[model samples]
Target: MPSLTDSHTFSLPSSCSFLISVTDTNPISLAALRSTHFYLLGEGSNSIFVDDFEGVVVQNKIKGLESDDLNDVIMLRVGAGENWHDLITTCLKNHWYGMENLALIPGSVGAAPIQNIGAYGLEVSTFIESVEFIELETGAKHKIKSNECRFGYRDSIFKNDLAGKVLITHVNFVLPKSNYMETSYGELANLNAPTPEKIFNTVIGIRRKKLPDPRQWGNAGSFFKNPIIDKSLLTQIQHEYPDIPFFCISKTLVKVPAAWLIDKLGFKGKVLGGVQCHPHQPLVLVNIGSATGKDVLEFARLIMSRVKEKFNIELEPEVRLIGRNGLIEL
Candidate 1:
């Protein structure tokens, strides 16, 4: 058995029967591994192993970044295993404009589409042209256009219909050369004459201030998705707490910050065993030290129960929790 604590950001104590790192897309080799239980992993920023896995853990290390410069747009084919924040840094260095708003987000390029990773009012789905992947069962290669991915707020087909059935090989992105800054969200709105480089630096600064460094404190950023609720419910909550912050999604739907709700309930810096809810950003749950999977599950459940009882909104976990067999719902 091999220790998995160092593999994932949460740093929970666990091990797997086998740990394999795939640097290339070898269909035959991957297909053969399908005979046993296995979990696909990238940089392991968004996943936490809650217990000793009964089977193999396949780490995706497939790396490459190829670019095609079209006069108005730059087309990039990024390997699934490539670090996401590093890609954003490279884009900024090359004067690629659109991804600047998404700087400092952890995880791999492959995981980006699954979550439709977003920040500062910009989403990765906006620039994604298509996704290339290999079917684990049949060992056949396939490509799907971005529109067909069913991208939603913190969701996509990779997380639902195609999850656990395929392994991402590369992500195709098309970034326009034209300068269009997204300064509508939070601190970005305060930037004076913001450029891509400026936006990148600002976003990084905001995240650093709000989010804890995973190296110093074990954490998966934004443990829960901001719960989307009906306008009627938002009105009711607002009546009770006039300043309950929310983002209007549509005429009927609104996204209420999970952090606000948790913080209101006095869960900020709350601890259960060795796990603690982050004080600065209540959306994050951190492993203070020597935290076990049981502690994380219990602490999360407590928060979920309290939020539901008070707000009548169900909070869904953004982080994937892996148990002995596979992903478990909170």
Candidate 2:
């Protein structure tokens, strides 16, 4: 039984009876988990375990990469357990374009689809061909096409109907040979004709400045989803605070930065016990040294309540909270 104290980014106190790593060619590990209540853990980048898990915790370590050239596009079938950033780096090394804007994101490939990871005007779903998984109950293998994944802003079927019901084994991606870089988000917009490497480096630099290194500071990247609001509501808010920053998602929808909302409430660097709303980025909550899961959750609630009181909009967490009972939604 391996200890999982350091397994999650939040460093929340937790324990499990068994910790197993499943690989690409092996279906037996997943089969053994059929009769047990289990939770699948990836790189622990987005997990905030509130309490000790009772049964089993499985980490996907499947590794392999298969590629095929198809005219203007190249397809890759990557093992679910592979590091997400490493995959992006490999693509860049091989001259494969796409995924440049998603650099520096933490977590394994298997966890990418669960959250439909996106950044800099590009989303993982844009290049995803399909995802392969094995049913938890029967160990039956299946491949779901990208169109059927029900991808939305930081959400997917894996987070809903299929949550904890299957183990992702592989993810297929289709990348183009030519440059199709995205540099329209925030600071990247200032770049002049960015290449894959340029876009990758730029995104990495921006993220490093905004987020804390998990190994040292302890954080799970962005804590809240950017709130999408109706255009009318956005207009109403903008009328009150003309300087409120927003992104036009559509004619009827707009995205308001949750960080801005938190910052508005004077939460930047606010501390509750051992947790602090990172001084530089209010969007990230970090453990200063002795924070417990309860402390983090409580601190998050304070931030949420203040945001709701001020903006009348509820902020949702991007990090999955796992307690002894199962997934905890805040």
Candidate 3:
């Protein structure tokens, strides 16, 4: 077994039987795949490996880009192995409009659909046309339209019924040829006149100021998902804390920022062993040198317990935790 300490942003100590990097999708065979059970590993941005994995880890590296321009839309078929930030930069350079709000998301393209990655006021699901994946169990290729992806806040079909059964190979996005901008988020709400470059630059600037660069401070960006609660519950909380901010997801539901709740609980800058709740962004947990996976988990539990006790809301981790057996749900 080999230690995968550097593979994850958490810098957690873990191992696997073997690690294979698949560059291109050509010539894939079941005989080679079925010899050992495996887990698809992306850029390791959204994972926290709590323990050594006993099975193999497949690093998806498939890469390329193809475009078909229509009357008002450009359909882009992107290789899953490509860096997400690189894709956004390319789209901006080519005058693509839809991906500006999602700039600087740290992960590979293959992992985007799995988590339905999003930022600011836009989600990948909004621009996705379709997805192409290879079924690992049978070595069969399949395509599913974006509408069938079952997308939700930081969720998709890949995390549910199709989990561990397939590996995404490509994602096709339908981007607009003209003006279509999203700046509903508070930071971008006041932009005078936003272009693809302007929105992309704004998002990058905000993220840089808020999130610590993973290179300098090891962290999985936004450790917890924003909790969506019933509108009735939001009203109840609002009575006590009138300034509580939230976004209306539907008539019956409201999404509240987990960072606000954690900050309210006073966990920012708090440390447990080598792990600390980020000083600025309470939702992010950082490894302050010499932190182990267990250390990070303990710190997370502390935050969750306090938030639950105070707000009666359970915070769910956005980062996927990989254990010795398989995916571990906290």
lDDT winner? 1
Candidate 3 runs further than 4 Å off: 27-30
Error of 3 at 92 (Å): 0.5
| lDDT leaderboard ranking | 1, 2, 3
Best-fitting candidate, measured by TM-score? 1
Cα-based lDDT at residue 281, candidate 3: 92
Q: Write the per-residue lDDT of candidate 2 for residues 1-330, one digit (tens) a residue.
A: 456679988786678888877766456766778788888999999998777888789888888999998999999999999999999999989888899899889999989999999998988999999999998888789999999999999999999999988889999999988756777788888998777888989999988888899899888999999999998987788777889999988989999999999998888998999899999999999989888888988988888888888788899998888888678877
Clashing pairs in 3: none
Question: Ten-residue segment with the worst summed lDDT in candidate 3?
Answer: 26-35
Q: Name the candidate, 1 or 3, with the larger lDDT value.
A: 1
Compute the lDDT of residue 182 as modeled in candidate 1: 86
lDDT of each: 0.93, 0.88, 0.88
Clashes of 2: 0
Worst 10 residues of 1 by lDDT: 26-35
Candidate 2 TM-score, true structure as reference: 0.97
Error of 1 at 106 (Å): 0.7
Candidate 1: C-alpha lDDT: 0.93
